[model samples]
Target: MKKHTFMLALTIVLSVVLGACSSNNSNNGAAIETNLTAKEMVDQMLSKVEQPSLMELDAATVEQLYHLNPELLEDYSIRMPMMNVKTNEIAVLKVKDVKDMTTVEDAIKARATDVQKQFETYLPDQYENAKNYKLIKKGNYFLFVIADPADQDKLVADFDTYFTEK
Candidate 1:
């Protein structure tokens, strides 16, 4: 009776150990990385939301508004409200080098601050939208969005799917 009881206990322990090892191995899935162009990346993120009618800006205008050096980025897509009353904007950028990520992120943050200040006094409702904007960084990509709060989480989740391990 004692020997049978000990065997059952040992079998249970071994099963638990094997289960943990298999689970750990399963956790090591390959990360979802991609070499998508700027336009494609922006399109993927925007697809997750009910896109508003924002006008795309030219590279020169984007550089002027965000105070970023175009040479530092591999590619970028920027859109904004044509009129000042609405505070809707989006920018998805890919840095040429990882070392320049800080500069690019800083420029995006500065742009966000500018957006906030612009709408804070002009339109309270839009100001709230600006305040709830998302600034997301994933590997060499960066995204800044001032959109409807309802679409914020969906946008973030969709962006993350590009980087999350499968």
Candidate 2:
């Protein structure tokens, strides 16, 4: 009877240990699978857009390009003047990829001030609410930046700087 009881207690302890180990392994697997880099997310978003056309325009001309429709401008989170004129619509630039700097929290951390200044200089009018812009890091490879509708031109230009292939 003593040997049988010892065996039963050992079996219970072993089962508990096995269960805990399996749970930990599963959690680790999940973390690995969900670990996405920033660049990957940006690439994914860009891939979904119809081919983007590059165009340069002064700040004032942006409203005219989009037909001066405030409603249209308000419809999207980030509106670029590079539009599908046939449909009178702006292509949505989603967060498709994010690459975090090894040491920085923001994707454009080091370049943030420079980037902001560049936008302000090139597109002053749009920069009125530049502080409100949203920079979302979807993964390690993609950094999704949301531009205000009024800042479409500046945003488009900024976006081109990152998304355009070398």
Candidate 3:
């Protein structure tokens, strides 16, 4: 009877310890710290793809178009298709604080929804790209990409490498 009680207590202790360790690792965002600036990171990722006439966007233009203010970001890079008819865009942002993540994410989703609406009627392929875009977050950084579906996964995998390699 005493042996059974001892084993139960040990099992409970181990469970608590393991649970706490896993929680800490996840909450710490896996301690992702990259030496590259946001612009450099995005530029490198874009270089891997067969880009299609993308134009870099200034902060004011981003604010006007996406309703996401540059002031809230620690660093960022944005590129949109040169032609309004093309629905391809890439936005990579590092928020100054984790608390601002929801705000930034919400704005990006809204921008995606708006873009989908704009293209859904006139341009089928562009509309599909906008509808099936990838929006992902890692640590304090967020990446929102609307491009060829085949390229989206590669871009996300490349982004993960930045975190993992560090």
Candidate 4:
């Protein structure tokens, strides 16, 4: 009787453990790591809510915005950065190393400062959105979003789900 009980408990434990693991190879699967690209994750986020107008920055635009040496972050990929000037904005960036990570972090901060200045000068309406923006750094990726922060947790989780690579 004791052996039977032990066997049943072991079976249950094994089932539970197996159930927690991921079995899919696709990016959307419930895997241990994210299979989706940064752009894919951003698109997923956009699908979840009303997306704001964000202009994807080009080489010139990015260069003007950063206004620093070009070689430092040449390998950095800023995915589909879009901003509506006053309404809302979002930036998804992936870099090669920790040093570039700091540069990206600083860039976000500087952008926030720029937004603040805009608010002070001509667009007080952007204050509410800017005050509680979401900034997330997971692995080598950096995400900055300015929107209704009510869904911030969900947004972060959505991005985080794909952090681990297959």
Candidate 5:
């Protein structure tokens, strides 16, 4: 009976310790520092991702991606986005300053809303994926993704991993 009680106590303590260790540090924490810029990180991430089905935007198209103040951005990438179809799209924007990231985040949100409405109107049956686009921000790094529903989580995780490792 003493051994059983001790074992249960040990298990409980282990569970608590493991749980605390695995908890998310997304809030109330500083952003991870990295040697590479956002553009380099995003480019490296694209090499890991398999998305031959989609088309990548050129520098000219990427230049026009900023609906807000384009001058604020240090660099940005917009990939695989077709105006009407439910195709894979991913973009990462690097702001010149931390404060500018919020503005860029807002612009991304507006773009998301616009894309959702457009896709909903044109492809009513498959608007769900576009509406559920993964949007994340870390420090001056802002990530916006709309990928194949089946591959969405893996793509987001891959990008997050790149940032995490930095």
Candidate 6:
């Protein structure tokens, strides 16, 4: 009886030791390292020719302008969260000095229209979906979102118009 008990205890200790050793070996067997930064990622993405155009718009009384002329948004569609899958780049427009606008919603509408027009001109091909515009207002800034590269050339061509008209 004594001998049998000793054997059982020895077997249990050996099994526990072997299990721990195997687990440790597996944990150390593989390792991976990556070197990436936010700026670097942006640069790399911009370097690609197929990337979409991004722009920022600066304007005064942006909110008032939209309220005065909402029709200017004839060529834009609201952007949705799921649209990220189809977009290769994003353009942000910052509007300045909108003292005339009474509300944030008006400013957003105006800014979105302006940005959408610019995007439409810059990337006519990419805007084929006819519903690729997003208008977002944060504090005093309005954000215009554009996705797709099919209209990149049109976007470039329309660049000059953005400055001349606005």
TM-score of each model, in listed order: 0.74, 0.31, 0.81, 0.65, 0.68, 0.26
lDDT of each: 0.79, 0.36, 0.86, 0.63, 0.69, 0.39
Clashing pairs in model 5, backbone N/Cα/C closer than 3 A: none
Candidate 1 residue spans exceeding 4 A from truth? 1-32, 164-166
Candidate 1 per-residue lDDT over residues 78-98, each given as its tens digit:
888777877878777888897
Best by lDDT: 3
RMSD in Å for all candidates: 10.0, 16.9, 6.0, 10.6, 8.9, 19.4
Model 4: how far residue 136 lies from native, Å = 0.9
Off by over 4 Å in 3: 1-29
Task: Using lDDT, rank the candidates from best to worst.
Answer: 3, 1, 5, 4, 6, 2
**Tens digit of per-residue lDDT, candidate 5, span 61-131:** 55465467756777777776444455467887777886676678888888777777767767764477778
Give residue 7's lDDT in candidate 5 (0 to 100). Answer: 100
Which RMSD does model 3 reach against the true structure?
A: 6.0
The best candidate by TM-score is 3
Show the lowest summed lDDT stretch of 10 residues, model 3: 21-30
Off by over 4 Å in 5: 1-27, 52-66, 82-84, 164-166
lDDT of 1: 0.79
Q: How do the residues 1-166 of candidate 6 rate in per-residue lDDT, one tens digit apiece? A: 9999999999999999998865642224333112332233233334543443333212323224344333332112222223322333333233233353234445455544554554465555544432454433332223333444344434333321222111
For model 2, how does the per-residue alpha-carbon lDDT over 1-166 read when each residue is reduced to its tens digit? 9999999999999999998865643223332223222233333444444424433333344334322322322122223335422111123222222221232223233333433554565556435434344443212222324344444344344434443211
Error of 2 at 136 (Å): 2.5
TM-score of 5: 0.68
Measure candidate 4: CA RMSD. Answer: 10.6
Q: Candidate 4: deviation at residue 127, Å?
A: 1.4
lDDT of 3 by residue, 1-166 (tens): 9999999999999999998865644225356778888888889998897768888889899898889888999999988889888888888899998778889999999999999999989899999999999998777888899998989888888887787523
Off by over 4 Å in 6: 1-50, 53-91, 98-125, 128-130, 148-166
